[model samples]
Target: MTIIVAGVVVLVLGILAQVLGWGAEHHEAAGHAAAAHGAAHEEGSSVLIKRILVSLWHSNLFFLGVSTIGTVFMAINYVAYAGWSVMVKRISEALSAWVIPGGVIMLLVFFIGRHDIFHWTHDGIMDKLVNGKPNPHYDEIIAGKSGFLNLPFYVIRMVSYLVIWGAFSWKLRQLSLQEDLNGGTYWFHKSITASALFLVLYAVTSSMAAWDWVMSVDTHWFSTMFGWYVFASWWVSGIAAIALTAIFLKQAGYLKGLSSNHLHDLGKLMFGFSIFWTYVWFAQFMLIWYANLPEEAVYYNQRLGGFEGRYTGLFYFNIAINFVFPFLGLMTRDAKRQMIIMKIVAIAILCGHWSDFYLMLMPATLRGENGFLIEIGIAAIFLGAFLILFTRRLASASLVPVNHPFLDESIHHTT
Candidate 1:
């Protein structure tokens, strides 16, 4: 906790330095722009910074959303698999710590920019007087989902999801640490039970969240596979995060007990999940394409529209990077065991998923194809925040599960 508090302070200062340093430089350049051509060009560069910041911002929010969902799912997997992932579980749990604050910021962003992001938040447009009674512009649809999609209800649902997932993540992590100290089964049993309960809740909340956050952008569209599709997206992303973190820890001289076997396993999972995600992607695409139903086809049409070409390109490229590259790159047993090879694939996989999510969110929100400064800024801030938090948490504790009965199993993690 002390580490977190101190790290937050340092991070705030770093962000402030960035803002002040860059802002001062821009202000001075702007003041001189009228006097010189070079100065005017320098002023143009500030636009670039703004665009970059926007891109970072959007990317960061996407990461926060995916990572939070991944944390909850990973915890659920720990219970369902009934095996030890104690070695990497801390990394998963830490991924979620960013969710509460991230979600709050996102909510603020949504409300502040409601006109830009959401069509339904307007009283004059979405909500209006009809037949002497209030009727939303998207009345029929909104009426159908009034129970779940109204602002008040939406806030409550979102809070419930966050609170449940956050509580489970913190508690499960506490138990894992407690077990390490007490060397008892009691904490383990409790953790397992709590994880089980959380898993059931996670499924429901994850589906709702995917719908609420992403799917609702196209309020008229609906798909039963949407939830599972999102699951596959973030599951692959989360696993890649684990692999990347594992590699970093190995290089930094922590988790030295974790051998190449663990790397191989993590790499293999990344490879396999990439394939699984692609399968889900193609399955969803193929069905909609072949069916040719107007409503269903609208989703693709909007995605493949002229305004969304770059996103579409990334959408397909995500397949190549996530599925093809990893499939070939990690195919060999030897390759999966090699840390360098695994890290490269891990990066590719993570970037691919990031693009994958960019496809999911941006097109729906911006209603356009290309990313911008706002997106970049958001992504950077969130990425910086997570890196700071995760690293600090790691530094404060032992990397290995020192008291686990299967700690040896994880150390050797052999096939």
Candidate 2:
């Protein structure tokens, strides 16, 4: 009930802020041109709405990626037969329940808000030529990629990826429940087989989804490392979430068998993945910076030089929060083992990754428009919704898997 109420409050606040923000933009535009107040107001409102939608889209994707990768965490454990995480696997599974609804919301946003976020989808841009030469509207680079980026094919890929992910997540949950009821190796074998297949599907679609959903934002730019970078961000965020959840459950006395040893493992993952995320970030930036190609450099220039230099602060700040804090905060073994410190670091990593996604997304979508209220309000809405969904799912089942083959191993796990 707390989660539900909080979700409602945050969602209402976000909607209200969006309305107020649009109104403010409209009023400012009308003030600038009294005679064309109506026209200017309409245009301004449209632009502001687009900005809000793009921000919401990115926020939704951040939460969605976190949820989807939670399932991947479970699948990896199942395939590896890792015993340490058996006690906490249910937390990961519960978190993954968000993906079904998240995927639906994502698809709806893409269909309705594509024009707002995707430059390539705007009308008159695909075929437009500038003074009989290549104009910015009809970008030759984007045009060349149109065969793959066209609306029909793009929609198909989006649907296919969501279906695949949703199907696997559902199957895994079902198999786990059956395993709980039946308590046999038969269910375990089935889960292992399904997990093996899901991993393969995940490897391909996760990267392709990154390209379609994120990399395509800068339609003219390309990066081979983007998929891995995105995976790292999502993976690290997922691990942090698990650690945070485990800490909370442990404090509540709900997770009796979960031990500090299990948390230590999660902490190690969170620490290691934070570095991995930074490495991919640096690799992508270093290669682009080294080459200094006009097309490539333009991406950073817009982000750092500013939409025209407004986002300069965010460019550096993103690295500091995502990389610096995690690197130093969780360096010591004692730090990882302490619940208080782990909770703080986990929350920081989650926020840092959200900022990272915002930096990747907003430059392309919002341009120079920045507002604290809108950003926070939109994020709160998603955060609240995720909590509501995750907590409700968590409540529906035993906090720990009771009949797993490795239950004893996990229960007695120590470091």
Candidate 3:
């Protein structure tokens, strides 16, 4: 209740500040214009609702990715037969509680704000040579991608992805609970098979969803590594969230079996994935920037300074917050094992990734015209709602996996 109320207050204040202080802003990406020399131009109209809708979409994607990745983290452990994470796996399970809400919010945002969020959603944007003349609404680039980007197919993909992910999360949690009741390998083995299948399916849907939800915002720019980039970002954020929650539970007298060794392992994951995310970011950015192809280069140009230098700071901030901070703060093994440090770092990673998602859509859609108050309010509401579900789910189950095959190993896990 506290969480929800605080979020609502923040949201109301944010909306008021945005309306009374900023007033109506331009519809087009604030600082963007037609790209020159074969670069595709993204067009926009002045829609007042565009701001909130984009903010909502951004938050929805962030929470949804983290929630899905939580299940993936647990599933990957099951697939690998890892023992060290048995104590903390429940944290991941709790996160699954947010998947449905996140998906619903996703569908809601897409329907309400499709036109503002995606340039391709514009009517007739995919038509070619209408009436023997180039159609005024024709986008040659978008038209070429029309087969996959059409509305019916797009809706189908989003709906299917959510359904598939929600089912997997539910199944995994159910199997875990059943394992506790039966105290046998039956559920465990079933989980391995289920997890293996989910991973294979995830490998495909994760990337395609990234293309649809995020990369499409740019309309003309695409990257081969975007799927991996988004995955790595979400993975680190989710794990950080898990580790942070575990630390809190430990301090609050839950997960008494959890030790510094477990904290150390969690820290290592945070540190390592932060670097992995950076590697993908660099690989994607350097390759595109180096190639200097008009279409590809213009993508960076928009965020780098093409838009009156609005996004340049954010681009670097994303790197520093996600990579540099973690790299420096968690370099020492002792740091990861420290409860306070772990909590602080986890909170930082969460906020950092939120900003990362912010950059993903804002530069292309909001054009830096977004207000932080509203964005923060939406984010806070998401965190509160997710916590409401996560904590409820967490309390409803045993914090410790009483019958986990590796419960002993995890309790005694050493880094």
Which candidate wins on TM-score?
A: 3
Summarize candidate 1's per-residue lDDT along 1-415 as a digit string, tens digits.
4444554565455455545554444335333432242221122224334333334435555666666754665566566653346577667766776766666666666555544444444443444467778653435564566566678887788788778867777787788778778886777668778878988888898888878776776666778788888777777777888888888887987776767877777877888888888788888899989989886787787567334243566666777897899999999999988989888988887777777777776554444313333343345446677777777776666677577655666665666
| Ranking of candidates on TM-score, top first | 3, 2, 1
lDDT of 3 by residue, 129-171 (tens): 6778888778889999999999999999999999989999999
Report the error of model 3 at residue 101, Å: 1.7
RMSD of each: 8.2, 4.4, 2.9
List where candidate 3 sits over 4 angstroms from the true fold: 23-47, 129-133
Give the TM-score (vs. native) of candidate 2.
Answer: 0.90
List candidate 2 segments past 4 Å from native.
1-45, 128-136
Note the residue pairs that clash in candidate 3: none
> How many angstroms is residue 180 displaced in model 1 relative to the true structure, after the best TM-score fit?
2.4
Q: Evaluate all candidate structures by whole-model CA lDDT and list the values in order.
A: 0.66, 0.82, 0.86
The superposed Cα distance between candidate 3 and the true structure at residue 408, in angstroms, equals 0.8
